[model samples]
Target: MEERARTEEEEMTLEEAFVRLDGMVERLETRGIPLEESFQIYKEGMELLKKCNDKIDTVEKKMLQVNKSGEYSEF
Candidate 1:
């Protein structure tokens, strides 16, 4: 069966996104896709990048320690 492009709202793990982005890069480097499809793939890769960044930011925030006084700050 053919695989369809994933929508931004679709749930995907960071590793999965990275794999997809890598595939997109390889396809772009090979340079056989039409201009429109290339643009679409590029856009999807960008969205995946943003998702990865957001996940990292969330992990960073979670790593912060909270003091006994209820005050908290990121390390």
Candidate 2:
């Protein structure tokens, strides 16, 4: 069988990722969890945060492209 890669949508959109991360924060702040579980939640939240940041950076680059000069020049 051929191997397959996961799609970005299959993983999680930046919005979805942020929502989950926010949930993690609420859980940590208001609802206490076992130390072990807290670490896992924090780790997962960090990973999601990276994905959201990456998406934001991609959007910023595209915006810069749209705000180009006379013509689209290589950066």
Q: Write the per-residue lDDT of candidate 1 for residues 1-75, one digit (tens) a residue.
A: 114445542467888878888999999887578998888889878977987898888888778688888898776
True-structure Cα RMSD, model 2: 4.6
Query: In model 2, which range of ten residues has the least summed lDDT?
Result: 1-10
RMSD in Å for all candidates: 4.5, 4.6
- TM-score result, candidate 1: 0.68
Indicate the residue-level lDDT of 37 in model 1.
Answer: 87
Error of 1 at 40 (Å): 0.6
Best candidate, lDDT: 1
Clashing pairs for model 2 are none
Candidate 2 to truth, TM: 0.66
Q: lDDT (CA) for every model shown?
A: 0.78, 0.69
